[model samples]
Each structure stands twice: as C-alpha cells, then as structure tokens.
Target: MDTIKKYLESMFEHLPKTLEVMRAKDELYSMMEDKYNELISEGKKENEAIGIVISEFGNLDELAEGLGLSKVLDDLVSSDRRYVSRQEADDYVDAVVSRRFMLSLGILLCILSPAGPILLDSIATATGLNLFTGIGVAFLFLCAAVGVGFIVFSNYITKSWSFLNKQPCYIDDETIDYLKSEKEECQTGNGMLLAVGIMLCIVSVIPVIVLDAALNVPIISDGVGPSMMFTLAAVGVFLIVFSSGRNKAYKKLLSLNKKVFAREILQQFADAPDNGPEKSVKIERVTGEVVESDYKDASYSSYDKPEQSSDSTEKKVKNFIKVMVKDYWKSVLCIYIIWSFFTFSWGSSWVIWPLAAILRKPIEQYFLGGKH
Candidate 1:
C-alpha cells in the first residue's frame, strides 16, 4: 500500500494537466460514493460495496491522460536552462565604468601634471620673468588649467566611451529566458562576468591619475617630475594588467558555470494530471525513458537537488550574488594587489618597505616561494 501510494504520488507529480485530472478523480470518487450508498440500501454488504467501488476506479492511465504529461515531458527535455541574472549585468556595467574611468584619469593626470611646468617655463622665458612673482603666476595658471581640464576631460571621455560601447547594458528577461531554454543543462554563465571585468578595467585607471597629479609637484624646481610620473604610470600598468588577467579568468569560470533545471523538470512531473489514458500513457513512457538504463548512466544529474521552496523569487537574488562573487574574485584580487602597490608607493612605503627588506629572508621564503 505504501509503495502504491508512493507510485501514485510520483505519477501525480509528473502530470501537466494535474488540476483537470484531480477534478476528474474527485468526480469519479463522488460517483463511487453515490453508487456505494445505493448498493448498501439495496442490501449489499458495506465491505463488498467498497471493494466493487475500488475495483471500478480502474488503472492509473485514465488519471495520467487527464493531466497532459506528454507535452510537459517534451518541453523539459528540449528546454535550455539559463543561469544569468540582472545582478550580473549590473555588476558588469559597474566594473566597466570603474576601470575606464580610472584609466582615463591616470592618462589625463600624467599629462596635466607635467603641463604645468612647461607652461610656466614658456611664460618665464617669453616674459623674461626673472622675478619670483612672474614665475609663480605662470605656474599657478598652469596648475589650474591642468586640474580643471583633467576633471572635465576624464568625465567627458568616460561618458563618450560608455555611449560608444553601448555598455552599462542590461540582460533582458527575454534573453535570459531564451538562454534558459537553450542551455538546459547549466544556469551560470560567463557573459556577465566578462562584462563586469571589462568595466573594472575601464574604471581602475582614475586613482592613478589622481596620485600622479599629487606627485607632479616641482620637487627639484626643474621641469623633471617625469621620473616620478613614470614610476606612477608603471604602478598603474601593473594594476591594470593584474586586474585584466583576473577578469579574464573569472569570465572563463562564469562562462563555464552551467546549470540544469532539475527543479523545473521535476515540477513538470508534479504538474501531471491523474485522469485519462493519453496523459497516463505519456507520463509512463516519458518517465521510463528518462530513467532508462543507458540514459541513467549519463551526467543528467547536473540539475539535481531541486529546491522545493516557495521563495524562488528570492533564489534568483542569492544565485546572482554567488555568481557575482565567483566571477569577480580575480578582479577583486587584482584590485587588492594594485591597491597595496599604490599605498606602498605613497602611503605605506615609509613603514613597510624598510620593514619588509629587513625581514627579507622570511618575506622571500613566503611571498617569493608562493607560500603566502
């Protein structure tokens, strides 16, 4: 009886016309009840009447057919599942904006910082400003132009690039749905990861520019702050390289992160109907085919462990966060390394460089050996 109940439940789960099948079953039960009462009134034994009614209920095929299992099964096998989300799309856009902004900022700052000295020198030479006051005015004007120009130019370029690329783009619901239907085996993907990575590279260049501006101070009075700017640029280059590498790696992982719609397929089964022969035959056939000897040995369990939660709306959000972190780890790591280098050059070098060099033996054994 328990086995029978389990089988019935399993069959019920697979029906597509579940509501109609259940309604028909309920009607059949009602008919049985009425017939049983009349038999009792006609002097048949109660248990005998019950036995006849149970027998008359017949096989499971009638119920299966009533539910429409065939079409649902077909859809499940042919469906392509998608693992992308809006969060990934948005994150990618942010990354692009950040990286592009950073790169442009660095370039502009490097130009502007040195421009101050050249403009001052030109004025000094042209006006014969041997006076301290004349030199100071020329320098001030150059600095002002560089600073203002940097702010405006960087902003303009960032906006223009964004527009040109048609980025800050979003994944439409239709596209997501299509992916879901086309890639039936996997849910996660690399498209959004790539997008975010590109964005990050674009935005990470800004801080380098800001730092370069600060470094452009006339440290030696001659027009030779190029060395400092060069070093800063090198740091910027390394950061960009590391970030780009990480983004590429993450994009690959994201692309590889595929998902099978186990829940959706299972739900299709649960939605099967319980009345009629056509649906019953389809259900039985599909289930047999899905669990057949050869097919069972394959990797179809990729979509296993389907969730039964009613909060699937929330599941999308959680899935997005997971995918985002997984896809952006490289970017994050690059950012950290670059940040460390940046801070060391300007901020922590005073304390860190001497300390690290003094402890070089251990530092080399750890970081150099890749043991850290």
Candidate 2:
C-alpha cells in the first residue's frame, strides 16, 4: 500500500545510497509486500495486515547488522558528526520548507494588505465621505494581523533547525556523496534566480510610475498606483523567496559541518563579481590613486609589510560577520514591519526589500574590510 511505500521511503531517507544498502531496501520491501499479501488472502483486514508487516520488519536498528549496515552504523556512531535519524531529517526539512513559505507568504500578504485600504480610500475620495476610509483602516489592521501570524508561525516552526547554529550536522559520507548529486539535479540555480528576481523587483514599480507620471492619470495617485505596485512587487518577491528556499534548505543540510559552513560564509567576502573590483590591492598609475581591496598587495618587494590579519584578528572578523549576517536579517524583519505600518505607501514601501537585498553585499564587504 501507499502507506508502506511512504514509510519505507522515510526509513531509508537518511541511509547511504550504497548499492548494498539499496539492494537490501528493495529485498525488504518485496518481503514485506509478500507478507502483506499473505495476510490479506487469509482474511486479515487491510489495517491489520499493514500493522503486522510493519511490526515484523520496521525495526531498522535490529535488522541493520544482518543487512550489512553494521559498519556504516558503527562509523556514524563513532565519528564526531551527528547521526541523523529519519524522523529528525523529516522534521528539519519540514521546518525549512515551512519557514521559507512563511517568510514568502508573510511578505506577500503585507505588500498586498494595503490594496483594500487603497481601494476604500479611492472610493472615499470619489464619494467625499469618511465611511470608506474608516473601513479601510480596519481592513488594513485585519490584513496586518494575518501577515504577522504567518511570520510568527513560520518562526515557530523553524525552531526545529535553530540548534544547527550551535553545532555541525554530520551524516554518512556515502549519504553525503549521494546528496551532492541529488542537489546538483535539483538545485534552484540562484544565479539565474538572482538576476530574474532582481529584475522583476526593479521593474515592479513601473506600472505605478507609468500610470501616474507618463500617462498623467490623476486617478492613479488616488489608489490604483499603490494597489498595482503591491500586487506586482509581491509577485516578484514570491517568485524569489518561494523559488530560492529549496536550494537554501539543501545547502543548510550539506553545511551541517562547521568547516564547510564556515567556508561558505567566508567565501561570500572572498568571491568578487565579474565586473566588481579585484581582490588584491591595485594602484592606478596615471592618477596615482590607491585602490584598497580585501587582500593586501603582497609581493617580494613588500617583505617588510605586515600581513593582512593575525590569526586572532581573522577569527574575530569571522565571528563578527557571522553575527552580523544573522542580525542583518533580524534588522530586515524589523524594518519590514515598522516601515510597512507607518508608510502605508505600498508602492514605496514594497521597494525596501528589493533595495535591502541590493545593500546586503556592500554591508558584508564593509565588515570584511575591517571597518566593523
């Protein structure tokens, strides 16, 4: 039955994708199916048959040694890496997916929340009455409540993964290798996403601008401009957040190791954009202008020059950025909430996120430059 298949999948989800392990999984499934069929033929109820089948074969720990998984299990248990169970993986992954959507949907809801108010305001402007304006304020509060609910629930659900910050995640080496390939096949390719997402966001305000400015439509300022801006910008944000979340989740899973995770964080500072400045310092010959960079201009001629950073300084910088990145997102959350409530100018307000994302790189580079 489908239930047995799902259970089987979940049970093996954390196991290595070794040929021996995979063969064992298939053989076990076939055996269980046969037993299930026998029970059904003997007038056993469907639930009863499933229960018996699971009870007989579902104890993975008891059967692991016989299935030639003793060595794998022993290695995982003895190593410094944490051995993840099927249930743990499921919970963590669910947390990742749910939390991502929570953020995405929350932003979308907040951006669109003003639409009703704007519409009501437009009606009030047309009718010259205060009734619709009052109703619009109430509607805005309702929408804001729903948006906050989404964000809070997402924050709560993501608690399952919060402990990952304190420790490294470790799974089987064989499983890690398998996951590498799986990730390649399914990765969201953020390069394209970044380009497309940023482009969409940059252009999201065009509708409002075109309507109000180029078209010389006074009605646009009354309400339609902001409503359209929210709808469009929210879609762009939804595309980015909803699309990129899976890739981020997979990366989190892979970087459960501290070294790998640290490298990932540090690399953000190391990598230069194709059109961005070089990593090493360069001097402009004609202008005699000094161009500072992430790394010092090291050469045989500069033997007397002190090195870029001492080990202590480098480690401190690393910790600083790690904390900064974490806090940066929290700051962003606060900015989103506060500015959204005060401005109520959805057209201008929704643009903050797109602009904030653009600012993230420079802020990181600044800290990397020892300006922290």
Candidate 3:
C-alpha cells in the first residue's frame, strides 16, 4: 500500500499544481485504493495487487490529458531531468565532507600565511644572509606554491567523486525521506550558524579592548589581542563555511529527487501519444536516455501563448540571475568589505561588481557545482 502511494505521488509530482490536477490526483488515489482492496478481496497477493493497480493507472500522459495538464507534461518533458541513487547520496555526502575538510585546511593555510615570510626571514638572519633579498622572495613563492597545490589537490579529489555527473542514479523511498529531513535540519543549522557567526564577530573586538586596558604586558597587549581577534574571525568563517556546505549538499539531494521523480513519470509514458504524435517518444531504460520526437510541425502551439512565453522567459532569466547572485553573494560581499576596510571608500568597492560578472560563471561551475 505504501509503495502504491509513493508510485502515484511520483507520477503526479511533475504535473502543475492546479486545482484540477489536485482533484484528479485525489480521484486517482481513491480509485487505486479501491482497486487494490478489490484485488486483495479476490485472493490476489499484496504485491500482485499493487502491480495491477500501478500498471492500470500509471500512464501519466493519459492522466495529464484527462486532468487538463497536457501543457504541463509537455514543458516537463522538455526540461532536463536528474536522478540520484542511495550509493550516490552516500558518495555525495562523503564528497561534501571531503570538500569541507579541504576548505578548512585551506583556511588554516591562509591564517598561517604570514608565518611563511617570518620563517624565511628568521632562517636568513640566523644564517648571516640578507633577509630582504632574492632568496627570501623565492621561499615566499615556494610557500605560496604549496598552498596552491593543496587547493588544486582538493579540487582534483572532488572531481574524482563523479557520481553526481551520472544521470538517473537509482534511489529508494528511505533515501528520499532522509534527504528531505536532512534539508530541514540544514536550514535550521544555517540560521544558527548565522547567529553564532555574527555574535563571534562582534565579541572579537571586545576582547582586544578589554585585554588592552586590563593587562599591561607587551605580549598580552600587542600580540595576544590581535591574535585572539584573528582566531575569532577564523572561527566565524569556519561556521559559515560549514553551514553553507551542508546546506548545499542537502539542497542538491532534494533537487535531484524532484528531477528524478519527474523523469521517471516522463519515461513511464514516453511512448504515449495523448499529447500528440510529435510528443510520442522512447526512453532507453538502462542509460535513462531520452529520445524526444521531433515536434517541428506539431500544432501544440496553442499550449504556449506569446505573452505566456515572454513571461516565462523573463521569469527564467530572473531565476538564473538570482541563483548566480545567491551562489557568489558571500564572496562578493567579502570583497567589498575587505576593499572598504583597506581603502575606507565604499565607492571603490563597486569594482567587485564587474569582477563578479566576469568570474561568476567559471567560479560557479568549478567551486559551486556541487551545491547547485
């Protein structure tokens, strides 16, 4: 019975949320329930009953046309569909954890970056060599290369976890429910992270002020104060990165589930011609490959009006822009804040806009693809 319900839900998941569709779904559910009960009463086994019920009513194209959702089906079939399996979900989680660890390591390296110059200077001075010469500069570059190597290696490892790139990865109901719950938890975690991060940033300056006034020791006054602040800032950044990574992972799972459900329904009715002969198609089951029928001469243009098309286009463009901004807004904000702090000019911070525009696509593709 649960499997029957889940199958029906998947079939209707891609349909539009219209009142008519909703009513039709309810009717279909009731019909299936009745049929299942009848089959059981007639001495059929539970599995056999479920199979019969689903096979009888699982043609989504027929359901869609009956429920006045032919247009919705058409649009859904045209869009790309994605799928994820239980193994892929586990792999995705591992990849996210690995990436987060790498990010933390990168952050640690950055915080210790000043040590590179200081270490080289100390070594040169101890060896009676000039500390401000070519050797020191070369060592500094070597330190930089090491940091870059860590970043490059992290990226390579992340790309090697290519389960996400494979389409129609199989998944079960338990995985879907787990991912949905995880997504909710991630949202709550993000909120808590923001609150804690802001609190840390604010409290960071307080220690410097209090310690400087209370203690007169040079180490405490000069060194410890700034170091404490840097530590707090680093912690705040860590929280934000952790929260963002988890949130992105959960979102990716949820998005994949939705796409996969839609694709499954599309495939179920792939050869049906209720939408017209042009929309009749075949999908390769093993590869989950879709071969769409050419609809060049299809008279289904009545489903899409010029005004509706324009509005949809505009909405899609807006959504793309919004996603792009959401993905990189933190980096952009950080750049602006850093520039403003150094130059003390908010106007000059505007330079980040053009830089963001130029780098946003590539950065998203390489750095944020997992999240998307």
Candidate 4:
C-alpha cells in the first residue's frame, strides 16, 4: 500500500495541482488501492500485489494522453521542479562578475610571468653590461608565484557558487527575462571588446615573427619578441574573459534548468506529495523506540547538492586542473615542448599550463556545442 502511494505521488510529482488533475489522481489511487486489497485477499504476496496494481494502472503519460493533457503535462513538468528565485539569480550573476575578472587577472599574470625573464635575458644579451646571475630566474619564479596565487584565489572565492554548475533547477519567466537581458548585453553590447580580444590574440605572435625576421640583432628579435607576444596575448585573453562574465552566468543558468524532467543523480528523492497539506508526512517519536520512517508528516526539503561544508576553495581548483589536463594534456604538452624548444627558455614555457587551464572551458564548450 505504501509502495502504491509512493509510485502514484511520483507520477503526479511534476503535474499542476488543478481540480481535474487532482480528481484524476484520486480516482486512479482508489482503483489501484481496491485492486491491491483484492489481490492481497486472494493470497497474493505484498510485492506481487503491488506489481499487479502498478501494471494495471500503467504510467501517468499513458493515462493523461486520452484527456489531451499530455502536452500540458510535458510543459508543466518544469513548473513543479526546483526553480531559482530572482535573488539567487542576481547573486549568481554578481559572483560571476567578480569571478570572471579575477580569473582573467590570474591568467594574465601567468602569461606575463615568462615575459619578465625573457625580456631581461634579451636585454642582458644585447648589452655589454652584466647583471647579477640568476636575476632573471628569480623574476620568472616571482611572477609564476603571483599568477598561481590569483588563480587559486579566484577558485577559492567562487567555490560557494559551484552548485550552479552541477545542480539542475528551473527558473520562472521573470528570472528568464532578467537573465536574457543580461546575457544579451554581454554578448552584443560588448561587441568591440570581443573583436579586439580576438584580434589581439591572432596578432599576438605577429610581433615575434615579424621582429625576429626583420631585426638584424638575433638576440633582440628572438628574445624580446616572445616577451612582447605573451604580453599582448595575455591582455587579449583578459578582455575576452572579463567581457564574457554575464554570458557565463546565463549559460550556467541554462545548464541547470531541468527542461525535460527525468531521473538525475541529484534529483529530489524524499517521499513528498505534490499536493494537499493534509497529505504531509508526520513522525511520532516514542522514547526508547527505533525511528524507522524515512520521512515524517512535515519534512524539510532541499535538492541533493554536493557536501560543501569544510571544503576548501582549492579543492575545485585542483579538480579543474585535473580536468584541464585530462582533456587537453597532450595539446598542452606539445605546446610546452615546442615553445620551449623554439625559445630555449624552459622557464618561460611554464606560462602555457595556466593559459590552457583558463581557456579550457570555452574551447571545450565551443567544440561540444558547435554546429555539426
């Protein structure tokens, strides 16, 4: 009997609580309950009785089809599912604004890390004056350290908002309207930023190629060109990242929108009714008695989210690094080896790793969501 009620609840879970729908649900429950009792009286086991009743009633979709509520059910499914409120949406967008800037700054620093050492080395080679040995090495390591700090800090600050990535929820029309405007502004309003960013990236290495070929001084051309190239590319990427803040927020919202309601790993699991205050679960506690019920008359509700308590911000950063490497390890390795060989500055080549991490999501999303 409990099994039958639970199954019935799940079937109507996403449906609207209209009079017609409620009437249909009550009638179906009555018939199923009668059938189950009849089967039990005939000596059918409890499990066998449940199986028979469920099979006889069939699924909700099949039943709703005759009443022309199939389309209604399909559309209303998301209405009852988890939804994001306006406040939550605003908080997310604001967080992304800061996060994107920090993330871009971190990547920029990483790109500029090798630039310092390369430029210094080039100047030293071109000049007759000798500087302290290992000065360039110290500067290289310093920039790398600062870059790592920014990246890690960005990851830390955004850790609380990571739920927008993995958890699925719906949003009301109002929130949708709000997000649409923000997203459009990000994509269309900042057209110049996007274009300039791409232009900078495309022409970033042009200085190296042009200067290396045109300049008679090999030390100046080869050394200084790479340092300048990284600076230009880093600034370009920073603009791209910063400009896409709202765009990222909107995408995150859509990804979390459970459009087609179905079983998901993080879907709600408690045996809660979709209607009727009287149908709420209640638990009566008896002293020295075992509490066996999964739910009581009144139960608290929340989506199944990852355990965030006691989790350090670095956890996500490390996980992203792993994912970044897993998806783009070969490409990063090839770039590192080739660039190191080309410039003969292995220390400066370390910049590529952070750059790969910063750009992984966009590149992956582009290919994954690209039109075939």
Candidate 2: tens digits of C-alpha lDDT, residues 268-343: 4345342223322222221122222212342223545566655588788788667766555456656777887687
lDDT digits (tens) for residues 199-300 of candidate 1: 433444444455457664443223334323433443343333323323332332233221122334334544655343354344445554332222333322
Candidate 4 Cα RMSD (Å):
17.8
Off by over 4 Å in 3: 7-31, 40-80, 85-90, 115-147, 152-180, 205-216, 252-372
Each model's lDDT? 0.41, 0.66, 0.59, 0.64
Ranking according to lDDT, highest score first: 2, 4, 3, 1
Which window of 10 residues has the lowest lDDT sum in candidate 3? Answer: 287-296
The residue pairs found clashing in candidate 4 are 281-296, 281-297, 282-296, 282-297
Top TM-score prediction, candidate number: 2
**Per-residue lDDT for 14-91 in model 4, tens only?**
454457777888988898999999999999999999999999885777778765567667766654345567788888
Give per-residue CA lDDT, model 3, range 1-372, as digits (tens).
899888987876545445767888898899899999999999999999999998988887777676667876786677454345567786787788677656645443433333334444545555667753355456445644564455455656667556554664334456778887877866877789757855665576666688889997655655556556655654655555555666666666666554454455565454355555434433323223222211212333454546465558777886666665553544454555467558845223333433453465566655444334
User: lDDT (0-100) at residue 176 of candidate 3?
Assistant: 71
Better of 1 and 3 by TM-score: 3
* Ranked candidates (TM-score, high to low): 2, 4, 3, 1
The 10-residue segment with the lowest total lDDT in model 1: 348-357
Off by over 4 Å in 2: 1-80, 85-91, 188-196, 213-217, 257-327, 340-346, 358-372
Backbone collision tally, model 1: 58
Q: How accurate is candidate 2 locally (lDDT)?
A: 0.66
